[model samples]
Target: MPMPHILGADHVVVTVRDLDASAAAWAKLGFTVSPRGTHSPHLGTGNYTIMFQDDYLELLGVLTPTDQNKPTQDFLAAREGIERTAFTTDSAAGGAAELKKRGLEPLGPVHFGRPVDLPGGGTGEAKFNVFRWPLLENPGGMRIFACEHLSRHTVWIPELMVHANGAKAIARIEILTADPKAAAEHMSRLIDEPAIADGAVWKVPSGGRRADFVFLDAAAFAARYPDAVRAGATTSGAAALVLVTDDLAKAKAIPGAVTTGSAVSIPASAANGVVVSFVAR
Candidate 1:
């Protein structure tokens, strides 16, 4: 069973050095990027979202130095890529309570909001309550958090859902690790989910239509994403994001995209250190 109050994948956060540059890069890949939204002053961050049917992607950048954004600043100093992934939660407070019951310490059920530009006119606040599974509790080299979106409609606007690449959803997240089994088990325990052994790879289903987290060793990751994998790349953390696209041709048409078998992949060098692959629906 899944963790209490935790729904499947909500969105993936890609920490970037330049918000505008990252947003433009994603737009070049055929995604319809949303207008940049600045978070509360205390958070000292901003983001541009790529909305999907159910899940989405956030390209985040540090706007100013703040104690709250230290982790993000540290990540940016090293490299820019997938910083964390958020799970949808019915209630942030309930999620934290469940985590405590599981013998895990949960961070704050903090409330924050960002002003969003409405489609037609005016502005709206995208409110959210969130709790983290500890800053250092990075399972599978990726940080995990639960988010309760109080103003969903302000964020997932219908107009922003359409993409030129025909991307519909995040199908899978690939994590490269020295030991896939251990990484998978760690993630499974954190989420109260089962880890399925798939030959040399391990899979943790996020439930429902949400993307599954696939953990594999370096060799396996290189074999699966030959064109996307960089030489001597970090052996762990989020390596790739696979999206289900309605039109494979459009994905293949992206500049610097490589087609291998059924999927078209963009190397990490071009995608802010995250390999992006598109497979037909």
Candidate 2:
């Protein structure tokens, strides 16, 4: 069963070195990138969001050096790509408390907001309350966090939902780990969900209309995404992001995208280290 306060997958944070350049790169891939939004001074970060129906992707970059952005800076020092994934929660505090009950220590119920330019000629604050799983306890070599959107309207703008690639929602997130079973079990403990074994892969469902987290060994990952260009030299961590699109033809038309049977994939080198694949829903 899922955690009481924890909903499902919310968004994935792709840490990039250059904010504007990364946004332009995703735009070239046919995604409708949102206007840049800067976080509060304490956070020292800015981002552009690729909005979908329920979940989204955040292109995050450091604007100034601060204690809060140390982890992000460290990750960027190595490579740019998905540094962490967030889960949806109605109450960050409640989620944290539940995590404590499960013998896992959560980081914080941090409060922050970004200024958003509303489509109807007004400005709004996209507020959020978030709490993270222990920083050092990176399951499947990726950080996990839970987010509570205080102002959903400011974040999920309808104008930003349309994409030229016809992408609708995140279908799945694939992680390559040395021990798929161990990785899946660790994630299961964090999310309070069961990890089901399927051949060489282990699947952890995020519940609702969200994506599943699939963990597999290197060989299985290679077999699954043969044409994908991995981001870093490391064999562990997030491997691919698959999206459900309305039109496969439009997705295949993206510059530099390769058609792998029924799916169209954008190389990780172009997408800040995460292989992006599009499949018709």
**Candidate No. with top TM-score:** 1
* lDDT for each residue of candidate 2 in 1-281, tens digit (9 for 90 to 100): 78998888999999999999999989999999988999999999999999999999999999999998999999888877889999999999999999889888888889999999888887889999999988977778889899999999999999999999999999998887999999999888878788999998999988777999989888987766664445442467886899999999999889878887788888787898898989988
Clashes of 2: 0
Q: What value of lDDT does candidate 2 attain over all alpha carbons? A: 0.89
lDDT of model 2, residue 180: 93
Candidate 2: deviation at residue 158, Å? Answer: 0.5
Residue 9 shift from truth in candidate 2, angstroms = 0.1
Q: Summarize candidate 1's per-residue lDDT along 50-87 as a digit string, tens digits.
A: 99999999999999999989999998888888889999
TM-score of each: 0.97, 0.96
